[model samples]
Target chain A: MKPVEIIDIDVSYGAKKILEAITFHADAGEILGIIGPNGSGKTTLLKAMSRVVARDSGEIRLDSRNLDTLGYRELARQVAVVPQDISIGFDYTVRDIVMMGRHPYIGRLASETLRDVEICDHAMHLTNVAHLTGMSIHDISGGERQRVLIARALAQEPKILLLDEATSNLDVSHQVEILNIIRDLTGKITVVSVFHDLNLAAYYCDRLLLLKDRKVYATGTPEEVLTYENIREIFQMETLVKPHPLTGRPYILPVYTHQSGVGTNRRVHVVCGGGTGSDILQLLHAAGFTVTCGILNVLDTDYGTAMHLGLPCVAEPPFHGITPESLSGLRECLDDADAIVVTAMPIGRGNLDNLRVLLDYRTKPIILYSRNSNSPMEDYTGGEAAAVLADLETRGALRVEEAEELLARLSQGYSGRS
Target chain B: MRRTAFITIPALACTLLVSVACAAALGPTGISPGSLLSLPNAWTIIWDVRLPRVIAAALVGCALAVAGTAMQGLFRNPMADPHIIGTSSGGALGATIAIVLFAGAGRPVFAFAGAMAATFAVYFISRKRGKIPVETLLLSGIALSTLLAALLSFLMYTAGRSLHQIMFWLMGGLWNVSWDDVIVALPILVGCAGIYLFARDVNILSLSEEDATHLGVNVEGLKRILLVLSALVAGIAVAVAGSIGFIGLITPHVMRLIVGPDHRLLFPAAALAGAILLVWSDTLTRTFTNDMPVGIITACFGAPFFIYLLRSRMKT
Candidate 1:
């Protein structure tokens, strides 16, 4: 069952509507991450849930009860918020700040009981801020202060905790540390945090809500919501989406947009294997060339890089020699290419067809990148592959020693394709 | 820190006792130590004249300092005081109106009403949506205070025969205050007790309004209650002793530095420190010169300290 449900909420500041018809529900014992661009009402949504800002029209239900009917103290007992920036201008001890979270549980004239003190102490220990209990908050580091604020929220013993960019100011290690703490609290407490880091949200949150235009653009698990198209539409930036090798969660790599040189429209087919063509393919694709790779085994690292870059490829099954049908598919790719570039890859019996396909396209403008001068050592084909490479060079194939030299030659040879 | 508290509370209590005794003993007609053997004359002077004034000073000091502490906590700014948001000027305006027109038993009532009006005006003006941004509230308070001060000067200029009385009230002295004036201080005592009950809430408020709300504090309601109570205490203090300066502004700050920001300890400490400060300052005014206003002495001490606070805050 959902612990909290917000239905058709609308919030306005004066005449300006900050949020419109926003609806979502946070299940019990799950972390719901809110992700959006700035001014998309991410923080405003969190504030509305915490009742810091009153929603103009909507009903918020906590534990199946209408929120407006609950007293502030009762609501506070259930929900606690750790704000983005907590400025400790005065000298308040860490213990004193944490003890403030017990305000809802204590009576007006009564002080904190022994049990209350133990809860605060346990919260400090959970956040790793117990050692700084007696120290002034003003004297702590920023990361330590963030932890102390989280600890303060935890001391509320709240069933639901709301964090608004709580870890934005921390370094990577601290961010992971704090998020790990929140992640571990999932089974006992519900957490709804606004995250600026997409990767961190993907890693830590159980489900994600992407907001756009003051509404929920998408909501699902991280693998379902953090898609390249959704991110491109919302954030208006091109990104590469790949799965994390260890966790299988979606990871985002931002494509840099500051390329200066004019890119040509020429198509280049790279014939290489054993990870040699990875850098060449990346460079050519970044230079705005249509790149394709061919006759590569499916499990090869170069094929993996190609799949990650979304380039079309002709491939065979893992550890299988190139068949006649695959060689025909490579010829079709070579036919569509304006130029061909081959990297310094070892020639082997299992992939001898790759070198033979290159010989067939010898008349075309082909650049052979032989970084290793001793080609005989890589000839697992017993001088047959070496003899074929020597014949290709004699048939007017361009010999380049480095990737940069290969790029310089390609750009020079294909200038008119622009 | 607990050790400091153990020694400091008793030491402060002793100093307050000694100050009260010394202030009662030294006056225009100095009671000689040997003359204390004659109980009749000494008792008459102590009870009739010096005792009332000393008691009045202590009450006014305690009221103003506690009100100032509440104001500072409400605004979450150390520089905030009773007068920063025009509450004192509002009370002064009310008192001036009473003296100029009614000239009777309606002074405290009118003053309390005026202070509440000013507080509500600033509170409403500074509010946006549901939250009151501290910076906007501070700026609005300053703007309204300047406006109120102008209106007060105009009223003073127009009062022909009551001009001296108006100036004396505005200057804030403790002369000729009988037990009748001390009766106005009763509300201040009640208000201080009421504020102490919410001392924990006030401490949470010092963090931020939203933070306090998350901790189950009704921030808007708490602000309203504290603002009204502070204005009441400050208004009564002004009504009884005129508009004494600096005791409210400096005493709470000194106490906070010594006792930390825990309102539970800071409030009582500030009350004691304020009572002692005003009693001594009033004594100095009476002893060093004849019938000089105590307001001048407090301002003389308060103005430089205010500047020093500003400079130190800037450096930080």
Candidate 2:
């Protein structure tokens, strides 16, 4: 049997619905993360599994035993919850709080046994809170308190552990530290947690269950569930998803849609190479411009970005000269453009045609763009690329530094053309 | 010693024993150890008057303290106490009705019923979806207590000759306590031990009701049991000695500071200390103040201490 499973559950508070038709299962000893935007019933779903909230209609089974059939203490022996940072009103010692976790096993009218003490000590040691056991819980830091709560849960020796955004209140480093401790406990304890930070969920969870507006939008491996299209559809935001270079896990970066109106429906074909065009490409795209780029090597960083943004671009094979086919593609992009923006990129023999071609578009408005005043694009073509650029400048091409200046000039609609 | 359970429980137990003996000997009549051998009526005075009153006072104090500790833990609010939450008013109202209608027969039964009703009313009113905010509970307690007090006053006004009896019960004292009343108050021990069984559960509950439930505590079951036990004991205390205020509220809070919030240690410590406190309060009032109601003494200290708690809590 699976460790836990919820079958077609519906939950509501009074007449208002919180979760509907929710169904999922966790493997024996893997981290299953529940992720969604706020109000997506992520926490409510966890509550149902823990039996904290009554399901309107559904069946939750733990180890094939119906959840409702288990007694409270029996269920507690199987599942433990580490909640978000909570305020502890009384000043209990760290050991005292952890010892309460053994409550389910200890019968009423009986005190904790020596075996219980040993278990509590072991739990504190595992959570790295053994040294702080004698300290009052109120005197400890927030991170320390969270670890104590985890230690308390561990003291239960549970088969399943649940966390409700257990580290959302901590700083990034603390969150990572707590999650690292949790990650180490996975094989021994089947873990399920609600996560507010998607990247953290992606990095840590073995499988992710994505929720959108009270329904399971997707559930699978992180790569399968956290796709660019799925995110846009659910959260209405654009993102760039790539495999992490080291871990090979899918990492996501957001692509903005700021809609500045400076370049709405206006095409600006960037003449850039060697990653110089990356920032300009995103900026133009975000500010409502029809951004395009051209006549570059396929292996270039800018080309990868254009592919991610789905921008139209013309490219030649890596380390090859621009061929007639790619040159015609760049010419067509230029002819259809409202203006052209060129960054100070390294020019070389392989793609010198990029600048030479810009010389042909005399009447099209061109802005020689640089991110900073200090570094112009490096001259690798022995002054030949410089000569081409000077000739273009004489024909009414303007040189502007800074993205703000670029946006300002573009918003003017380039009346200087022709 | 550091107020650990190992040292504090025995030490407080010893103190309570010595306090009870000393209080029983040193009444207004001045029956010293030597006088006890000489005076003819000293045995009668000690056995019939002082001993029962002292035992009843100690039991009543213990009952209030245990009930207070349970309320604070169950609500996860340090300020929750039986008297503050209107349980005492309910008991007093019931006792007054007993005096008016049944000529004071079956007073404890009436008081228990009234206290139980008020406890549930306040609990259900303040609670929302298993969580109770501190302000809502306190405010509702105040509202219900005021309403109960108004009813109690109307009963007293219509009571005519029984008005003096109602007034004496409201002020709360151990003036006429006897062996029969001692037998009546003995069940406070059972109620306290029942609460003690859930000490570990209350410790978990002090975090949150949901947290307690997650840990395998049947939270709703524990809540009902605690409410019934608190009402039984507080109602018993009110029947025995009228509505003694603040012994419950002050004792647990003070003991928690010394012995920590672990209900295991807190229960015993508060029980002993509360007994000791009310024993002394009763001793002083009868010895020096000519038997002013013991409730006056506790409230004088308890209300100011409660204000100080509020002030310090606000500063934090």
Candidate 3:
């Protein structure tokens, strides 16, 4: 199959040009993701590609045929679109809704044949929504409804599928699950989707099309397109680009700095648990300390909250416990630190060794706060765990009453606080 | 959320049947229910006079509702009515001209002519080069209706002694309905039903013009057919009964609230509901007082309901 080419397309609504001089080609079987901020004409571009929006002067071609020459039925046979908003107030069953996709194939007064029903069944099964066949489209869940829409598009059996923010309202698992299905469809069908989640786009799309000011800002593989400089230029955000450990995809981490007379003076490092280290990270910043957090996985709420607050955090893959690499990364952070705060966290088999990293650094005073029974890190002081805790206690790590007491001691020039 | 379609259909049918029976029962001279069936002439009179009028009422009701539903979908607007596309004004203008120019001639033919003309005019004015601006279609229809209303008023003024007859026609009534009028309207109503059988396609058109076009519907052709069919029904209804108010505009809206937006069910249900509503309204006018017109009765009920809908929509 030949590539879909958009050549020097310019689209304007009234006097304002929404898209300006766009040129590109999307090959068959390529999963291309378009990313841009609001009002950047991502939707307008999609509309142009579908030949729904009139361009000022340009040509869009599919398999060497100018899109303008192709009839609507012919276009429908090749491209099926799943819009972001499906405003259906009609009383159509899920099956009926999906069957509407076969409209281009069915005769005007003809009913669906056995083959049409089979195709619809296959589409529903692929979307895992056959159970909703008898249900009204309005009566289903948003996630389920979204899947049904996908199923409807799939039933069209098009060579190219266009999805505009398909996973916007879905939950985390649903988002990942839907994107996986879309990814798996890449080799069989050309896919173009608009995504707001940068990480998701990085993980799924073979190539990223970043639109800036109605122009194609950059287009390449995730690694080339997701660089820190390009993101700062296109998205207008200052962030750090780091590589994922497993997939090695580039992930973004934002940095936020506060200006204070105190911050200019000192710097502190925290080894904390259950995200209790957040306050110390904040206070240290308010008091002019350069702080960094580490070893927390991507799913940890504290890690997310930290990122939202614009802290420089080093997070690991979340599991039942921390890995050796996480322990080493935490130790490296501890070594570079002027002071260390070891907050009371549940000593599980995964992270018991995390606390043990404080053992190697003997010179720095380690502030150990008593674990409240209600605290998450309170459980599982085992044979090895007990020995580790005893050894730390014997080493004269300051046993503190509360986080505030530790802060007070730090203010008095002792060492650090958790 | 759960709907009982079977029960709803029968309940509406029963109401329509009862309303028709009552209308026949309460004429200038009170006719006995038993006597109605006994006399063969009485049966002919009821079927010919009362039944045609009732069927006309029902068919007109359905036509207006279906047209209204189609217009709403075509414009992707909620408050749109069947007549908003200048069909009624055009039809009325056509009927008015035929009454003035070819008085006592076949009024239905002229009325249909004027209606089709007005529909085409509105269609052209709204179309720029080749593209139909949905917003422009609405604004142009409003402008045309206002212009035609002014012309209609001028014609009424020059009509002089004929004004009384013209005024009655303007206000609308089914008093003079006969088998001939039914004969005239049957084909139009049948045509409307045939057009409405394509209601499933109209559902797709309601989403977006682009979506409709891409889905293999001839968007422009479908629009033209729907508009012409709606005008025919409206024109024939007006010619048979004269400017009957509210049934065309109100019935479809009420049906939508119950049945949702699927036009397949909505069109037929609205037709039945409109038929029932108008029949009962006509019955009330004939039984309670001979002084008022059927249009007046419909307006009396429709205006407040329309206001209520507008107010509620605003709150949402």
TM-score of each: 0.93, 0.96, 0.72
Better of 1 and 2 by DockQ: 1
Candidate 3 lDDT at A39 equals 86
Quote the B-chain TM-score, candidate 1. 0.91
Clashing pairs in 3: A262-A287, A262-A288, A263-A287, A263-A288, A321-A350, A345-A377, A346-A377, B62-B271
Q: Model 1: per-residue lDDT, tens digit, A1-418?
A: 5799999999997788888998899999999999999999999999989888889999898889888898888988899898777886679999999998889999997989999999999999999999999999999998888888889899999999999999998899989998998888889999999999999999999999999988889999999999988988999886768799899999998876444343477789998888888777777888878889977989887897788678899999987888889888888999998888877787799888877877776457877776666652367888888888788777777778776777777877642221
Ranking by lDDT: 2, 1, 3
DockQ of candidate 2, scored on C-alphas against the true complex (2 decimals) = 0.69
What candidate 3 gets wrong by more than 4 Å, as runs, is A257-418, B1-26, B29-52, B83-87, B101-151, B161-163, B178-180, B208-214, B218-221, B253-260, B311-315
Model 1: CAPRI class: medium
Model 3 chain A lowest lDDT segment of ten: A258-267
DockQ of each: 0.76, 0.69, 0.27
Model 1: pairs clashing at backbone N, Cα or C within 3 Å: none
- Fraction of true contacts retained by every candidate, in order, equals 0.84, 0.84, 0.35
Computed on alpha carbons, the lDDT of every model, listed in order, comes to 0.84, 0.90, 0.74
Backbone clash count for every predicted candidate, in the order shown:
0, 1, 8
Q: Estimate, for each residue in B1-316, the C-alpha lDDT of model 2 and write its tens digit.
A: 1446678899999999999999999889988889888999999999999999999999999999999999999988877888889898898888878878999899898988888899999999999777788789889999998899888888888766565555666668989899999999988999999999998899999988888998899988999999999999999999899888888889998888788888888998999999999999999999999998888899899999988877887898
RMSD of 3: 8.3
